[model samples]
Target: MELLKAQNIEKKFVNHLALDDVNVSIPENSIYGLLGPNGAGKTTLIRIINRITAPDKGEILLKGRPLQPEDVNIIGYLPEERGLYKKMKVGEQALYLARLKGLSKRDALKRLKYWFGKFEMEAWWDKKVEELSKGMAQKVQFVTTILHEPELLIFDEPFSGFDPINANMLKQEIIDLKKKGATIIFSTHNMASVEELCDHITLINQSRNILEGHIDDIRKKYKSNIYEISFNGEVEKLEKSLNQYYEIIDKTKVDGHSAVRIKLLHQTNENELLSLIIPAVEIISFKELIPSMNDIFIKVVNEYKN
Candidate 1:
């Protein structure tokens, strides 16, 4: 079921249309990727959903009802711009933020200790925020953001400053959060992360939503009928056996096997291609070459531009 829905959301800023008729439905306990290039109004939409700014038109529904001011209590938001009191000690700042999120002092301390220990940050608890590195500060902020265990979490560029190890750690935490029934709206320019973590995505471009669907379905829709075949046969013989419906896009040697990428033309199906090639070569493996999210993003954005 959809936990959050935005219908016909529109936002304007002094002659700039930040969001135009943008709509998205985020399912319960799933990670929804809010994607777009820089200045494509993704931040504007996120802000509107967080009630940081009001929309000029349309409505936002949380759990099938009109969103209210109190709804923010159930939402955890980590904006792209990180902020913390530099002079305050790490533990002190975390406690302050947790209190603002309505957590009891004892409960907040318990949770903060657990998170800090898990993140190997026990030593930095008493240190000032200014003394920590960017990645270290980010860890503290992340812990505080989800300290109250909000049902809905919005993370904008969550992996921005972390190294590969820390990023992977954060990724696993996100997956764990989903398993624990938290619906996440992850906003990032990282397509690889989107593919790895997002169950569904809405691609916004030029202040409008251009694509929206499940990751697998979107990849299937954007596929180009390309197939990769690894067979033990001569490249020339394989090339000659195919009819005009097949076009060889790439050829390489994989572990002494001739691997070739072929594009099916004129709506030629896989069965037909296999039927023709089976008699001529020994088929070791065959698989469709699905386009990645990065490819689809570029293709869709360029098509919309044209």
Candidate 2:
């Protein structure tokens, strides 16, 4: 089931088209990545979805109906730019935000305590936001965002300030949310995070959705049919056997076994390649090379520019 869907979404500023005919569908209980470089209109689309600004042309559907004001209750958004009153105590601010989200005071305190304890932030609850570090404040914001258990959560640049450990902690929390049937739209420049947490993605560039699909399918779509073969073979014989049928992209020797990353020039099975090479070399391992999201990101963006 799709939790949210956008069709022919178009948004423009006074002189610039921020989003152009954009369409994206987010599946229920899945993590969807919104990826693109700066100025790609990622934030604009997010704002449009949140109803922060009216779209020039298009409509968004939440849970199979046109998005209405009531649908906002089911969405929890953590914007790229974090906002909090610096002078306000962390606990006070959290409670206030939770109440605004429609949580009662007692329930808000209960959830706040649970989240604060999970983050190991009990000691700092009474401290003012101004006294906490950037990462600490972000943690507090995260708690409030999820406290209401919204059906859909949108996080933009959610890991801007955390250290490695806290980042991993947050990553686990996101995965847990998904496991518990909460759909998420994660927007970040961190390709590593996309690979780790995203089940599907939409890549926006130059006010357009340049790419969108399941992560694995997109990776396979851009794969170059490259393979790495590891074997103990005489380097001279290996080169001669390859001899134009295979394009050796890289070669390395490790642990007495030589490995070469080769691309096939024509249709042939790995067994056939093995047949020709086994006469001169002993095979140890063979594996296909799949392109990473980072590689695909650069490749598609570059192709579009050209």
Candidate 3:
């Protein structure tokens, strides 16, 4: 079911349009990637949903009802701009934020202890926020964001200062959250993370939503129909073998064997491709080349700019 939806959301700032006729629906218990290059109105739209700012025109619905101010309490937001009081002790700060989200003192402490232990930050609870590294501070912030177990979690540039190991750890935790029935809205410029974690994505460019859909569906829609073929044979035989049916786009040697990449024209089928190559070379493997999210991101953004 759609947990949240924005319909024709429009927002403007004095002389510039921040969002223009934007619409997107986020499914429950799924990770939705809110992607765009810097200043594409992604942040503007997020603020609208979070009710930090109001849309100039359009409506936001949470669970099919007009979103109200109190809905903010049900949302866990980790903004791209992290904010933690520098002088506040880590544990003390976390407890305060949790209470602000409507948790009682007892419940907030109970949840904070669990999260601190889970994230292995229990030992650092007494340290001041300024004493922690950027990544360390982000970890504490993440714990507080999820401490109340909100129905929807919005994370912006979640891995910005994280090292590879810590980043992967956070990714795993996100996946685990989904498994435990949390809907997530993740905003980032990192295409790799989108590829790995997002089930669906909406790509915004120049304050306009340029693309939106399930990851697999979008990838398939943008497919180039390139195929990679590996065979155990002399290069000459493989070259001559491909002459009959498929058009060889490129050929390379990999691990003492010849590999040929081909793009089929009309009337060319996989069976036809295999039929021509099987006789001339020992077929090792054949697979289609799926475009990566990074490739799709560049292609879509460039198209929109032009």
lDDT of each: 0.94, 0.92, 0.91
Q: TM-score for each prediction?
A: 0.96, 0.96, 0.96
> In candidate 3, residue 130 scores what lDDT?
98
Residue pairs with colliding backbones in model 1 are none
Expressed as tens digits, the lDDT of each residue in 105-168 for candidate 2 is: 9999999999999889999889999999999899999999999999999999898888999988
Give the 10-residue window scoring lowest on summed lDDT in candidate 3.
238-247
TM match of model 2 to true structure? 0.96
> Which of candidates 1 and 3 is the stronger one according to lDDT?
1
Query: Which candidate should be chosen as best, given lDDT against the real structure?
Result: 1
Give the alpha carbon lDDT tens digit for every residue of 71-187 in model 1. 887899999999899999999999999988888999999999999999999999999999999999999999998999999999999999999999999999999999999999999
Error of 3 at 159 (Å): 0.9
The residue-by-residue lDDT of candidate 3 on 196-284, one tens digit each, is: 99999999989889899999999999988789999898768767866555678888999988898888876778888788778898878
Indicate whether candidate 1 or candidate 3 has the larger TM-score: 1
Q: How many residue pairs of model 3 clash at the backbone?
A: 0
Give the root-mean-square deviation of each candidate in angstroms: 1.3, 1.5, 1.5
Model 3, C-alpha of 166: deviation from truth (Å): 1.8
